[model samples]
Target: MFFAVIPAGGSGTRLWPLSRAGHPKFLHPLTGTDASLLQATVERVAPLASADRTMVVTGVAHVTAVARQLAGLPEENILVEPSPRDSCAAIALAAAVIAVREPDAVMGSFAADHLIVDPNRWVETVRQAIVGAEQGLLMTVGITPTRAETGYGYLQCGPLIDGGPLRRVEEFKEKPAADIAEAYVRSGRYLWNASMFVWRVDVFMAELARQQPELHAGVTAIAAAWNTPEREDVLGTVWPTLTKISVDYAVMEGAAEAGRVATVPGDFGWNDIGDFHTLGEVLPADSSGNVVLGGEGTEKPGALLWDTANLVVVPYSNRLVAALGVRDLIVVDTPDALMICPRDRAQDVKKLVDELKSRGEEGYV
Candidate 1:
């Protein structure tokens, strides 16, 4: 059986105003669907794992909202972190807990806030990864790069193993510069590291013990007390002491170097929805190339654009937002805050959130 673990952390500061610290982007319906990203993610993996076999690791602040969004999920499956400790700790916690239940289970970790246009192809890709995982290989689903995208990490793939589609991941590369990203795309050996990983709980725990012993020990102690009343006490006492690092840095990169990591290149119309420009690209645009959201099935659109080209506007205040003589701009209006920036500068939207924190404007953030 395959278990699905969704890491529903990350405030997604790049999509500010709409995606706040209290209410992150994963809880929003950014894909023009009624279901929020977290709900959609759980549903998307239903073919392989049911609600009982699925778990979500999120922060304490979002537990109530997460529970409200994922009503079918067991309350205990919703592992709440005392504080943010990055991906390694979050994922390790899920793995350790799963190990206690199903020591030989194959578990796949997927991000909560990504969009996959082709669910059928994605499911097939995950099936392939599960096969690799059953073979004692740590597997990652790598996306075939459609363009030179510098915003994401890349996996340099080696030869196909056993004359099939699965290939050994040669190296895990960081987000490269523009020229380096273009070079990586042109080489045809690089795949975008989407962070979708599949591995047996025992195998992953072994790797964790090898690479991140402190983290492995910390989560093991917490998992030992997970179903007991000591869960919260142990989590609060030990979680903050675990090293803060990404799974990529703490495990996958090192595992790749040790020839334990393999990847299946997937081309199922994947988008991270990292920023407004990327969101605009995935969503439907009007004839003027403007993408408007949050006004579906209503008398009027949430935004109005005249002489505007390639603008992404999200008006969530139930008020009509009008734009004129603007091109390639992102306008996001919420009840408490408004964000405007050039489309090219969408990646820098996190700066606004940081500035708000610097100014002690927590309410707006």
Candidate 2:
């Protein structure tokens, strides 16, 4: 059996303006759907884990909203952290809780803010990854790169394992330069690292202990007090002591080096929504190549375009947004802020968020 866990906590600074500290992008309907991204993520895994068995690890700030969005899930299943401790701590906390209930349970960790167009194929990919989990191998679902993407890390795949779809992960490569990303796609042996992981509860804990003992210990202590009255006291005391790092640097990369990691190629359409440009790709576009994300709290500003090609407009506010003679631009409109940048500079949004904090304009961040 599989128990799904969603680490529903990220500032999503890249998708800022629309994605804010109060209401992140994961709480928004970025996929041109009525359901929010977090709801879609859980519904996608309903067959694998029911509401009782499923869990969500989120920050204390987002706990209320996370619970409101996932009303079907048990309130106790929402593991609230004292503060942001990165993916390693978030996932470790969920793994520890699952380990307490079902020592041999297989668990899959999915981000709260990603999109997969082909849900059925995604289920199949996870099912295959579960096969790898049963073998005590840490597995990640790697998306087949459709193009040269410099934003995502690449997984160098080795030979097949046990004559199955699973392949030994030769190495975990970080996000590469444009030329290197292109070469990786052309080599026919690389897949975009989507950060989707699956493993038995005990197996993942064992690997986590081997690679990040301190993190393992902290989460274990928190989980021990999870259901008790000391839950808040223990979490507030221990969570901040854990190292702040991503699972990639803390575990996945090292496990791959030990030949205990594997990758399952995912043919399903997947999008990390890293920036406005990527969000534009999955959205419906007009003949002029202008995509507008409107409606649902955001009135249709009715973006007018002339000779514009590849424009991503997020009209979050009621104000009218108009563009003319623009090409490959990203225009995000919020109630308090409006951000305009070239499509290529989509990654710079995070810098803008940092600059806002540096200038003490955290009210906008």
Question: Best-fitting candidate, measured by TM-score?
Answer: 1
Model 1 lDDT tens row, 1-365 = 78999999888899998999899999988876667888889988999999999999999899999999999999889989999999999999999999999899999999999998888899999999999999999999999999998889999999999997899999999999999999999999999999999999999999999999999999999999998999889988999999999999999999999999999999998988889999999888899989887636655447767899999988877778999899999999888888999999998999999999999999978
Each prediction's total of clashing residue pairs, residues at least 3 apart in sequence or on different chains, is: 0, 0
**Model 2 worst lDDT window (10 residues):** 294-303
* Per-residue error (Å), model 1, residue 81: 0.7
Q: RMSD of each candidate?
A: 1.7, 2.3
Compute the lDDT for candidate 2.
Answer: 0.90
Model 2 TM-score on a 0 to 1 scale: 0.92
lDDT of each prediction vs. the true structure?
0.92, 0.90
Clashing pairs in 1: none
Q: Model 2: per-residue lDDT, tens digit, 106-130?
A: 9999999999898999999999999
lDDT at 89, model 2: 91
